[model samples]
Target: MVVPEPGLPAAVTIYEVGPRDGLQNEQGIIPTATKAAFVRRLLAAGLPIVEATSFVHPRWVPQLADAADLMTALRAELGDAAAELPVLVPNERGLDRAVELGLRHVAVFASATDTFAERNLNRTVDSQFEMFAPTVDRALAQGMDVRGYVSMCFGDPWEGAVPIDQVVAVGTRLLDLGVGQLSLGDTIGVATAGHVRALVAAFAAAGIGPERLALHFHDTYGQALTNVHAGLQAGVTTYDASAGGLGGCPYAHSATGNLATEDLVWFLTGLGIEHGVDLTAVAATSRWMAAELGRPSPSAVVRALTPPTE
Candidate 1:
């Protein structure tokens, strides 16, 4: 008898967050020119979904201070492709900005952990949703694509352990708010394969499933690959990854970062799954970005496959 593979599919859509999520955490201000070019290159690599930028307060996130400028530039530069660029709006104000700029897809964020809620959003976990209620309503009313983020699904930096019920309740509320999809995030990368399996099972029991959910994970402790395997086994096909493993949770301290898109593509490719992304180009771009940041490439595959410059 032959053993069949796991939830390996013929194709997958990678929502690229490197421009917003990846660059937001960098210590310095990335030049607007470089940021725009990054988007151009990533889109050129055949990535269908690329999160362009966040229209948030510069005081809260200085790195994205050029959000407006970047948004305008990407749209003008990409033209028709600009339709695929989605911006993140943390609240009503941010959403307003995105709408004014004529963006069709936008993301709203929340946390499932009390500790992160207080530190990150300066409100209780539930209150953050309340704050976002009006914006979500406005977005749905305007016929926009809304993606809800439920962060800290696996663990928390301050709270240490997070409850499964909290995640379900928060996710359920987001769904009730009419979110087209819920992206469960393991913010600090402390999640194990067993925990991944359990949480997906819990979400399933609570009326959430792969068809309406996405998984975002950080590779801080090196369990990201295994977590991907687990998410697939749980029937999830959509996953979020950064280029070259380039992002980390801002609310998370001493953590590594997001699962590299290149790594995810490599894994899927090995499984004979079509990710519709150019892995070779992804590796080159990862190397370039790592060089500009003056840091070691976090992606092991990139380090091995990319030829060394003399």
Candidate 2:
């Protein structure tokens, strides 16, 4: 039983990333219908924001190659509810694809470390900004809300222990480019509670308020939840989580599952915070997704709460 921290917000907004980030890293290709169904389930479970797909070149993220088809299907099925979907766009071309599909929300990803930028995007950190600038600008100009993702903000697989100032600098650039919110990712899940507090403090000191920041933690070291608790204490009200704890970075081989939505919901509920997510529905979705992946869920909450079959 966890006690509610006095400074924590009464409510938090969870940005569900399972559809894009989670399935992108899977070994097996999930059918387009299944992916679409997954998104519907997540919405039905009450997640306000769901990352639907990435428009990166198919050669890069083959799992989400069906971005167009998936979005088309979802737009048709969800109608007005489709407004909640956000797709990841790598550049002008990706953004064009998203725009063509009538997407109102999009996300652009960047890394705080040069090595990761080179390996992941085949460009230096600065070059990535140049590549992403036009997309960010165009998206915002078109009246679409943009979200920025700063990968390896806590620690990089190649560089290790990225400076908080460096992350802040990159994040500030993203904000300057007109991203409504910036999600700081502990890409390899190396952050502790202390690190989370310090990083949030640094960002706050730099004039970026908690309202403009979100935390995305991987559960590689079993510290995702602890860091989330610390994030709550720091007044960050937005977080990125995956259902069924699905997903890991293909570039960062050692990285593992993302912080599970179920686990975070359990923590938030125990702390008496209002997240507007149904724990049982999310757990059932996790169980169903785990079955799709042919594995047990990595989330402890899902495991313990899931009922046995007769």
The runs of at least 3 residues in candidate 1 whose Cα sits more than 4 Å from the true structure, single-residue gaps closed, are 1-7
lDDT of 1 by residue, 1-310 (tens): 2233755655667888899998888888899989998898898888888898888788878899999889888878977567558888988999888888778898988889878888778889878988788989998888889999988998887888798888889999988998898999999899999998888899899877777878898998899999998888888888998899988866677556789999988887777766799988978888888888998788888888878671
lDDT on C-alpha atoms for all candidate structures: 0.85, 0.91
Error of 2 at 21 (Å): 0.8
Candidate 2 per-residue lDDT over residues 164-191, each given as its tens digit: 8999999999899888999999999999
Assess candidate 2 and give its lDDT: 0.91
Error of 2 at 234 (Å): 0.8
**Clash number for candidate 1:** 0
Top lDDT model: 2
Model 2 lowest lDDT segment of ten: 1-10
Q: Can you list the residue pairs that collide in candidate 1?
A: none
**Clash totals, every prediction:** 0, 0
